[model samples]
Target: MEKNDLISDLLVKDDELAVDYYAFAHPAGFLDKTSVQEVATALRTFIDTKVVGNQPRRNVILVSHSLGGLVCRRAILDYLELGRSAGARIIGLLAMGAPHLGTDIARIASKFLPSHSVPDMQPWDELLQNLNRAWLQRVVNDGDPDLGLEQRGSVKCQVVFGLKDRVVPTASATAGAYLGELKAINKGHIELPKAESLHDVTYDVVKQFIRQCIEGTRTAPVRRAANVLADRARHLVLQDADSALEWTRYEEDVVTLGPLPAPEWLRCEVNSTRTGGLPSADFTICLALDGHFPDGVRIDYRFHFGRGLLTEPEYAAFGERLKNSELAPQDLDRVFGLKHLYLGVGEAPELRIHYEPHDRKYGAGFALLTYRIQPERLLGVGRTNTLHVCLWSIISRNHGWYSYRATRLVLEKLTLQLIAPFPALELGSSIWWCEPERNEDKIDNDRYSSRLEIEGPIPPGILVQWILDTESAGLSR
Candidate 1:
């Protein structure tokens, strides 16, 4: 690949930085000349002659884009296996838009372009899997004195990926099995390494990584935090049963009303009935469905909190008390970690309550809240089809961190109550709630609506469906 403006800019900005662009010689149509090993051999030869012999003891950073990344990795392994002093000087490796775990695009492309590299880029290819395993083994055994690779200095690897990359997915680009520092840019595969402007976030991130390599700051704080969070989330999943039972008392205190039928809409109310008996603390309520909504119909939602809708002053006062209380900081920190914890309107227009513990130990009395979902948007649409709406995203955000044993669903203009039992959700699984059973009721009343209540730990996502009988309902424009 040709040297781009990003490479030129990096060299211009830093006088100490020296960049060498390596272009492998191979015909695009040739099958036998461009094996990964052959490219790696050429790279190893170049490093031995130009990099090592001339600039001894200098830190060397290998910046590879696209398929060059895999070749570079292989060259590094070859250099290390040779026990050459130059290999020890290699400090950093940055892979941009590299498909380490393979890409489906390569698999599709291979049918037309008969290339050796394309085969290696297939998912679960033996070559790619072996390379990953070797790299992982090296990472795991880094600190061991027996490993000659660590005697000089461990190679710090950072993987940069494009968020909108279609050719190489984030999972493949990041190569999670390697446990390297992963960063993403809001660009596509082709634009990631070519980023030149200072305003470009990818350029800034890559520059920082290069600077760290030069300064010998190998520890990545973001990577460490991510690893820690993953471990914590795993532990939480394992102990979910115990945690669910502990919070069941609070779940019992919550009650739902309404979802009562209204003209072209449905309204539901949820409240905590703890009164002054229990201590005050932050609480979350989530409403979810197990399906998708109708294509043309839009649902409008509104939330009301407290005895009545809380005034600005009352809301601020409640927030202040929560912030100043003794247990507020600790409880908030435990639940949210380093994430910002505050009560505010979320994306789906749900009210998030951050309640402070009152009376020093228990949380305050239950707060009343109401949610209204209006389906008047369905009117005037020519098509009448059954619509499904998945509310998992809405519920997960509003409910904070508690697991629900059951969920309730309410529908307008239907007089029926559905009770469904969902299978026990597995740890770390995103699929938790079951699909709601659809039943047609022949009730004559037009004032009644349908409601569903689920009973166990609330799952992360929920789904619900709506049967749009446009002819009977007269919804045409």
Candidate 2:
């Protein structure tokens, strides 16, 4: 394509974020002089040949300001149809001042323009009306359509509104959850660049969001590792005569920990002593969080697992989707720390956990793991609809702390299927457990205390057992 003065002028600062930027070559009345299809075709060709080819797929986040956003939307549709593999990799679409519903400026500009002007540029007229079709809106806002605005699309969107923008009203920029809403200080309609904070902040949020997507898709699987560790953990606890506890739930506050270096895995432990040796831990599933979680924020406990529990087939499906999804790194990395593990909810909150092994040399085993599930703190939709225990092994025994304090689980069930034995006595701490006091007067010191606790969502027909075993007799023996 030949170089045009109009395109050169439009692309004033492509390097705003030290990356490829573009300017269009269409002249002042170019759209007016040409047919909509011709204008769209020319614009698409220019973007593909010049703009998009430079960046890797999904790595490019198109931040279109005003009319530029409209241009990006059109270009994306053409690119997808042209076999660009932009289905998932086209990370995010940020519309600074796009008039998805048309603007009054189009009306004002039309009065001065000759009636023969191009259709789309006529401002809120038939041409513009046809562009904002339901199909186009859906395309621009792709992903898990049911997840509101934020969860569904390969191309994420964030609408930036300038409170002081005289050209476009704030209402026009308001979109649902899929695309986040950002505000700028007194920035003009066409002069968003003039507000350095707005530009910098927006660019950072978008860049980070994309980076996380990339990291999540690229990170390796941790299911195998989690399984290995979980098995070891269970056996370790069962061997301690004093340590016979059930895994109520183990939820981790990953937000503060940032997206973990690898995907996270989860397993369930059931008590079998009650149901004549029935199978426990049947609903166990693991996840490789890899890079999808953002730093500092980790995963939100409320809706974190609703869509998170993916089977192997579901896991494999993400690969194809990644081709069209946006990729980015972790953002907001300061809230790093350990939280707690809870079981059930409300009046009978039980913090289910084995005694944490702090000083193992003196003796460490399940006898050391003591804790009940706390119901009040459980943040989930319903008890049965969502499982609570999510054990994260980010904490290493080499760290000297034995276990990470913040890495725990929360089970929201009513009863757990136990395949192992459980402690016979009950502890006094409503939701807390304590070590048994050493007394020389006792005959059989092997006896310990535990209560039968259950959470939500047990699959039908599957017999779950609750086991209370002496740590010393089990793994230790």
Candidate 3:
């Protein structure tokens, strides 16, 4: 908004990779009186003069901060609609602290300033909704020619936000509802595009995103993995082949009570196969804990189901099962139809079955059982739970891979948190997604060590692999 030379200050010279930067200047009054379309028109004029046909057919990366990001998006959409070649050249959009989704802060400002753009930034504003809907449709279609963008070319969209931003909250800045791979930095809204040095985390992430955009490798690995899983799940449920099932259980505990002592152990293994025209993967998890609680503890088994995974019919059946009084039997075996589990047309999408020992004798506090789930169901595609695991330890491992599929669905969001006894770790951990080149480095900490959040429409079923090393803390096996 001020006379800051953001582009010149941020885009330092790179010896290995040559890049040309351009900054668009507009009248200050435009911010208060002009509409988004008008601002976009001004931006389009600048691009036409400076970028279009000015260089060798190179792709262009639009890096915008704050309100400028919104203007850029509008201009891009306008170009796509007009069938302009400039639209095809847009490789990626790295929006920093831009309220792709309207921010409530604008609601307060609108009462004072009679600015047209300010109203457009209000939560659920009509203009914001229209833009978001169009953008989402384009993304869902993967930039299909039918959507106005070239079929062969794709635009990578990434949003970076400030965790402590007061003007724009994380949700608005990231635009989580419409965009995926939302990244958060430790800077404020004003400092987002003004990193002091290359060592700044925000600067590093922005640099990587720009490089990925230029190289045409903007899709995140997490999204690729999600797509694979979704496709497998669809095939398993839609085809006539019999479903394959695999079970795994890993646990570790410490019970230093009175007399009885239990051994501690850790085991991990993986087995894969193709059965009845469908692929099957299996994992083995083994953990042992030796400890006791004076007040007796309740091992809460919580299962989380991704949104939109259940069809209306399946949801109705699950509701009925919960209402059935006879189904309240405490016997886990009978409850799950003798196998301690069941999957069919009508069943709970997510199950939370608690296990409490009758007496504290301290001999394998929890049973060493193999919990099997069909690959399709475990990696849920449609209306089913795709992932299943026991929540017991401070450290856990999620290891598996899925084959690529054309019709793979998107994984909307993933959030993970660690319980006590485990100190909070910065977003940096041994988490790897999709390929070795891609790592989980864009992590944000809101003063909590046990919390990790990821925003995605990431492809399902790539490799969601990670290992938690607890050996240093004396947690073995």
Candidate 4:
């Protein structure tokens, strides 16, 4: 939080585009010693809270030079872990003479740089090696062999290195950068980030990259991705909900399209396998969500619980687990055999969220989970998005309730599914929906599901209820 000295020295003069810029700096050995990981952690926090806060439509492009590029990479890897998005809305990385590979100058010119930072940039430096290894696996290769670096849909990376630079080697600065994508300049390492004017080659390079980033956000794969997701959302139903959400594995898009927004008619499947705590259920309740974002998201999917049925100790225990670095987000947890399925991953690769356990505040046990629809150019054109949500509850056979809050978004279709064995479900309510245009069927031979293709916006505060008479209400095997 010290004066971000970088911005103090930076002069952004883009007349054609409306863009926002943010920069930060940390204390190094000059004033106070620091490490790249520390800087990266700070940068990650800044990104989540300031740069990308709550704005789904926003996009970010990281522009860094020299050692700062390593800071950016380390910070990125901090957030873009097993199950997180690009730390924030970061759509691209623009590195000017960054050292993904360690620099030869570390030993050759050690006294010229800070004691703490220069050593960390030495060839075969542990931090640089670790950073490069993960970057190669997660950012560069990332299993999508068909897509190019920029087209991967996670973060479009563009690299620029100085041919006349003497500080950081071209090989180090351009490490992990695609060979064909490298932009060579006659500037030095110091000159690459400092443009004399809009006429400077440095300015031209930066300008071109920014323009392409802006244009890319508005066209091509983005527009195509939106169209694809919108068209396929109806088919992207949450059909299979195990302890974790699962789906048939296969490559789909010609472009990875990464994580964009949820599409229209967002198909949601809520399955109640049992009314007990099990590997797939809460101790005494469970409702599983099998849904899709259509294209894909890195991690942006999120939902919360409000002290649901958790005693003070249990609530504290859960919060503790959340803080327990090893059990951080995307690290799955199992309680009574139930798998943590939010932001679902793995072979199934479906967006299956088994929502909250029980909350009486909603007048029903099921919480009304409101999920943000990131309008990340993947939800097609001509559509406005807002809070999207659904809920499922198993209460006394005498009554069950669900609620919806009207928002800027329209309800295209809502699908509700119930999973149970023959005996218990046979005694459950058969015709529950009041909506005339409803369809029902059996799934996996043991589950029952219903669908409603709504025509217009849903009324605000619409509370749905069902009452059924059962001989015995216990869940059947």
Question: Which lDDT values do the candidates have, in the order given?
Answer: 0.45, 0.35, 0.45, 0.45
State the local distance difference test value for candidate 1. Answer: 0.45
Cα-based lDDT at residue 240, candidate 3: 13
- The best candidate by TM-score is 4
Candidate numbers sorted by TM-score from highest down:
4, 3, 1, 2
Candidate 3 lDDT, 330-446, residue by residue in tens: 322311211122222225453432223232112222222233345554343333323233322211111112111111223443343333222222223222453223223313321
Better of 2 and 3 by lDDT: 3
RMSD of 4: 19.5
User: Between prediction 3 and prediction 4, which has the larger TM-score?
Assistant: 4
Worst 10 residues of 2 by lDDT: 359-368
Q: After superposition, how far is residue 430 of candidate 3 from its true place, in Å?
A: 40
Encode model 4's per-residue lDDT on 96-205: one tens digit a residue: 88877778867665666556776677888898888877776556633143333332335567789999998878778777475116888897777777755556677677
Location of the lowest summed lDDT over 10 successive residues in candidate 3: 251-260
TM-score of each: 0.41, 0.36, 0.43, 0.45
Show where candidate 2 strays beyond 4 Å: 1-40, 51-58, 80-88, 115-152, 175-178, 195-477
Candidate 1 residue runs with Cα over 4 Å from true position:
1-6, 13-33, 84-88, 140-146, 149-153, 177-179, 217-477
Q: What is the Cα-based TM-score of model 3?
A: 0.43
| CA lDDT for candidate 3 | 0.45
